[model samples]
Target: MIEVIGLTKRYGGKTAVDDLSFTVRPGHVTGFLGPNGAGKTTTLRVILGLDAPTAGAVTVDGVPFRTHRRGLHHVGALLDAQQVHGGRSAQAHLAALARSNGIGRRRVGEVLAEVGLADAGHRRIGGFSLGMKQRLGIAAALLGDPPVLMFDEPINGMDPEGVRWVRHLFRSLAAQGRTVFLSSHLMTEMEHTADHLVVIGQGRLIAAEPLRAFADRGTRQRVTVRTPQPAVLAAALTAAGASVDTAPDHLAVRGLSAEQIGALAFANAVELHELATHTTSLEEAFMEITAGHADHLAGSR
Candidate 1:
């Protein structure tokens, strides 16, 4: 489990992370989300001890990472996949990390295969494509077989196949009861992969909850009804306290469920062509929540 309490980081006069507190529990995949320059990467760095916090604390399994005797054995992370030395072979790279952390060389091969890079382990890091590098980074993260795993944008450069593999891998790890903390800008994949979410904007915590709860927080659930009698249905729905909007051939309804709308149509002996509920997608919800905190905004005078 990873616990962050009142975490804050500042560079010179600028504050990157601001009084952030959240728990990444075991047996779940928790996604960390934020807009650009919202301090997601900075928070990850502080948690991994790559950067020092100006205030507050972050810990993995009840202990600070830097103080752990075998930190890598307790926590595995891939904050920057492309930071490895280009001069070394993939195997050599893992070998060096393993040696530093007192891990055996055999475990290197194990993780290489686990990340689907067994065949490319002998190749130099410089020659690997961005996607291949991502795989190699994940291999290193799994090298220690740690109970806690953290990744930042693991699918950034991956192909469709690689992306699918990563989604399955994270879920598989969580199923095995590990704590998986991930940060990604890809909302669609995150919606499928993360069971919970910790969303931040402008370096402040906006939300921390289950994925379903977070998505449902926004006011975007609307019922769409298609019928030949659009005018009749719209009037009936409007009179029944539903905000109605007419579409090309459908009525977008607010403040009512599809069941309620269908019942109203049926009560009036109206023929219904289709009825469905359209909840906002994760991306849509995210944009709505972070709109006020966006670092850059556009406006026309």
Candidate 2:
């Protein structure tokens, strides 16, 4: 588990992260989300002891990450796939990390195969594509088989197959009772992969909650109803304080639950062929919640 308590980071006069507090528990894949310049990278750096926090504390398990001798055995992270040495082979890179961390040489081969880079392990990283580089990075992160894993945009540049594989891998890791924390800009992927979410904007916490709950915070709850008697249903829904958008074949309703709508329809003797509730998507919810927190906004054309 990872604990961040009132974390704050400032660079000279500019603050990056401010008074952020959240706990990433074990046995769940928690997504870290924020708009550009929202201080996500800064927070990650502080947690890993790469940068010092101006205030507050971060700990992996019960202690700071810097206190661990063989850090890889406790926490594995992939901050930047492009930060590796391009001149070295993938196998060589993992071997170096293994040696430094007192890990066995045999683990190198295991992680390479685990990440589907066994065949390409001997190839120099300079010749690898972005997707291949990401795979190599993932292989490195798993070399120690750490119980806590943190990935920043691990699926960037991956092919569809690779992306799917990564999604399953994160879920599988979390199922094994490990702590998996990921940061990605892909909302659809987060929706499918994460059980919990930590969302921040402008260096402050916007929300830290379960994925379903966060999505439920969206501004609108709409229900789509297809009925033969659209006008009758519309009138009934409007009378019940629902805002209805009428089409020739359907009515989009707000401010009422599907059960309530059905009950109202029954009371008015309106025959309903379809009644489906349309909750907000993760992307839609994020946009709505962070509408005022964006750092840069494009002007109207």
Candidate with best lDDT: 2
lDDT for each of the candidates? 0.90, 0.92
Candidate 1 backbone collisions, by pair? none
Number of the predicted model whose TM-score against the real structure is largest: 1
Off by over 4 Å in 2: 227-232, 269-273, 296-301
Write model 2 residue lDDT over 1-301, tens digit each, in one string. 9999999888776888889999999999999998888888888888899999999999999899999999999999999999999999999999999999999999999999999998998999999999999998888889889999999999999999999999999999999999999999999999999999999987889999999899988758899999989988888888889999988779999999999999999999999999999878899999999888887222200
In candidate 2, how many Å is residue 211 off?
1.4
Q: Worst 10-residue stretch by lDDT in candidate 2?
A: 292-301
Estimate the Cα RMSD of every predicted model relative to the unseen true structure.
3.1, 3.2
Global Cα lDDT for candidate 1: 0.90
Q: How much lDDT does candidate 2 score?
A: 0.92
lDDT of 1 by residue, 58-156 (tens): 998998899987777999999888899998999999999999999999999999998998898899999999999999999988888899999999998
The TM-score that candidate 2 achieves is 0.91
Worst 10 residues of 1 by lDDT: 292-301
Give the count of colliding residue pairs in each prediction.
0, 0
